[model samples]
Target: MRITNVAFAPGHAAFYFDDQAAIKAGAKQDGFMYRGQPDTLGFEAVRQGGEAVTILLQLENGLWAQGDCAAVQYSGAAGRDPLFTAEKFIPLLEQSLKPVLMGLDVATFRPNAMRFDQLDIAGAPLHTAVRYGVSQALLDASALASRRQKYEVICDEWGLPVNAHPLELFGQSGDDRYNAVDKMIMRGVAALPHGLINNIPQKLGRTGGKLSEYVTWLAQRIITQRSDVDYEPKLHIDVYGTIGNIFDNDVVKMADYLCDLEKRATPFELYIEGPGDAGSKDGQITLLGNLCVALKAKGSRVKIVADEWCNTLTDVVDFVDARCCDMVQIKTPDLGSIHNTVDAVLYCKKNGVEAYQGGTCNETDISARACLHAAFAARPDRVLVKPGMGFDEGMTIVANEMSRIMTTLKAKEAAHVDQPLQTV
Candidate 1:
């Protein structure tokens, strides 16, 4: 089959990550600066809706495969213009890459011929969102070409075992989806308000008090509650490097605070992500490693998850090689291609670093389902709930995909068991 026509359409996203953010200190269109970031993005106004663009590829085979692309509803906070990304990305595809991809054999489309993670179509670094959409379209076509599920294609290409089990997932609830409250009480899916960027005092709605206290109360509440599942709900928090806001980048103070937190949240461990971001990549790796080491020395079981500066497969390798954190959230979009994502997971496995196949609330259903194959093939420690942050939408997609794959495996096993005995 040959590529025939490439098209793009603008749409609206069903989910917005901006609601909870606007309730915090930064309420203006030009409010809140991510630490170490050069600009201030308007994260507040996106509550109305986020920009979504749908891509359709018409092929000579008379079949079509769809791709989804959307920036965070809070694009203003990132200092990006949504319309510009939409326009620039589609043409970049038509000009630099589409010429090569169009009319090419679907079976022979080499995905890594141009690596978006390292370069841009023009003179600038291409946004991961744009790269993500095209990469997904090609992946869908590849699966169609191979007569297999998209995830299976990656599994086969990387030589990952097909029968590996599904990855246990963690969810973070937002807006109208308040399952985190119930899920926590049931000791179900682990939830963090905003990973590291959330304001503990604000999210919990107390005028004055320490973040550690709220975390303690949260831990106490969850620990006291029993559940059918034996797993203790972890109090995972992503600081967005704002822990430094509380302590001014004092790693020693951060360690001391964690020690106190350990006292209250006993038996229930904490997975703290980006407690503080050191200004540079090396600084971050070293700082995170130092925190882990300090916690280890104190016999504190708190786990550190690296997020901010760890954007690509190379970053994953560096962080894992340096023993930066106990686990790495492999944000799938940043890889730009499924092949590199597979490589990142395998690298984490080879080096003994625990992995989490992570995606954002900004993704779509197609992308969400595609992630399931990776989660099962690699069996990462956790897979993030996706498509949207709403508990209903996200849980449905992730749970169904996991259930579908695992159920298929069981059916196959049962068929084998029922087979008549045969001579070897």
Candidate 2:
């Protein structure tokens, strides 16, 4: 199918669900903004009002598809270039990308993507938002043209020979209460939370005296509060740079922190993200490698994930090669190219780095679902709940999508099983 025409407009997305947040990435008050206001940390503030880039594409035979480009408030802190703002995607779509995208077959989607990469470097490359939005809309159009789910398009493109098996994935919820956790469980998520790095005073505001005490309380709450706990859930924490700051950048203290974490976080699986964002890429890698080495020597099973300094596919490769972290969060939009994101996840699997395909809360539905499709194709260790401020919307979309795919596969299997034996 050919992409005939393209249109785009500005939209809005939430920074967080609740009022109280640690990092304070968005503005405190409402204001008139042509583009969204950037916060102290240079994150786009759409809390009161920030913009999202919503895209519409007209495909051949009068078919159409939509996509929204959402970037995080703290895009810079997340290792994303801050200039990739929400409104930044508009011109790139109209001026540069349109000519290249106008005519292509749905089946040639993968190869067409490579052409996009080649087109990108000639001029200022389309920002991740621009790339993600266009790619997503095309995926939608391709799926409509092919009569398959968007995730199926990705899976087929990846040449996954395996059946669509049901897999367990986590819920990205900020609810620290029993009721909220229960709700997440009922919604069909695999784990309690893909927790944000709210452990800092600016956000968490003294969750407890020490990190261990706070973790102990969280563990107790999960173990005691919910009676319907089906799986041995993991306790995931995004520490930002709080741990390193608290320990004064001392690896010994950092090692001690992990040691303490092993005690409270062991009974349940533990994942710690951004234990420190030590200055440069080298510093961050060193911090991660030191932590990993210390954890191994001390027999700590806690998974250290690289979040901040590892933005793109190249960064993922560097961190994996160094054995700096146990897991890498493939922040989807940062990679821009869907092909690169998929290849990064596959590379991680080959190199023994557990992959968590996660992204910011600053995304919208279209981009969020696209990331979910990638997660399904890659079969990563965990997937983030995204495309909305609150956990419910993203969680529901991802869970339902997975359920539908599995149901379809099961029905196909059942039909095959019941077929006549004489044919064999």
Candidate 3:
């Protein structure tokens, strides 16, 4: 089947926080509007407009998909806008990609051929964000055309297993680290408290001593609260490279404390990610080695997942090949396209390293659905999903669509397996 049409929904609607005020006024009882970032891609806040943006695509076959491209909604913007969100590139999807995608054979589209590497975003007329949008829209449209879930399309076309529970980087939470801990737990996530205490002094309203005591208290509370839940929650404390840079003296001591906490919370695996700043090549390798050594000394089998330090598939392959890390977190946007991310996961698997399909805090259902499919197709050891406890709209439809596509693909494979051999 060919794509007959591609369309985006109307622009984002204005949102008001009347409910928050009502709660403060005691007009509401059950829940209060706790201000946290809205779910979006990383760039929404920085865009000239202060509105959340959502892009919807409708295929000729009646298949529909929507993505939240607003940057600030998803990524908290710790640093500069990632390459995908460069200012000059945002308009192509809003204007160009869709028209180009119409009437293309969905099933036969070759994803690799559409790679954006050749697009001169930094030179000539093409813009980086625009090219990135083209790639993303194409992937979305292709998935719709094939009637395949985006993740399954990526896995079938590209060969990677899905990782269910991807790592989330938790930056400083307002004034209280405990608040961050509580937020994660309430969201049904086991967290890694990386960099929270390490940069306490620099953070607003926090002292080093208070931070250390809070970490100890939080660790103990987490361990004690284990039996209270139906399934034991996972917890990993991130040093976020603060160990080597600012808290060198406390690095080993903190590691020992976390190790002890892990023992007390036995059966719940803990992951230590980015023990030191890993922006540089040598730093990544050194941190990986140090993490492995510490875990070994503690006689713990908890995994070490590399995030910012392991940026690409090659980095993941090299780290796993050298037995440097236990897990690698792959972000779809960071990888550019779904196909590339899948390749990265496959590479990790080939080398016996676990791969986790991670999500940003601001991701909407479109991206989240894609992540779910990736996880389902890859079947990683653990998966991270935010359940719809209060929202009422869970990803049942998206999940069903993905499951159907996978079933169809499996049936096709079985039929091929049973077919008689033909002479070439």
Q: Pick the candidate with the highest lDDT.
A: 2
In Å, residue 107's CA in model 2 sits off its true spot by 3.0
Question: What's model 3's TM-score?
Answer: 0.64
Model 1: per-residue Cα lDDT over 80-186, one tens digit each = 32322444566665677556557756663234424534555567765656655666777677667666666666656666567635566677665322346465355
Please identify which of the two predictions, 2 or 3, would achieve the higher TM-score against the true structure.
2
Candidate scoring better on lDDT of 2 and 3: 2
lDDT of 3 at 34: 34
Error of 1 at 231 (Å): 3.3
Error of 2 at 75 (Å): 1.1
Location of the lowest summed lDDT over 10 successive residues in candidate 3: 13-22
Estimate the TM-score of every prediction: 0.82, 0.85, 0.64
Arrange candidates by TM-score, highest first: which order?
Answer: 2, 1, 3
lDDT preference between candidates 1 and 2, better one:
2
lDDT of 2 by residue, 163-233 (tens): 47655666665523335565665554555555554445533334223666656765776666555666467
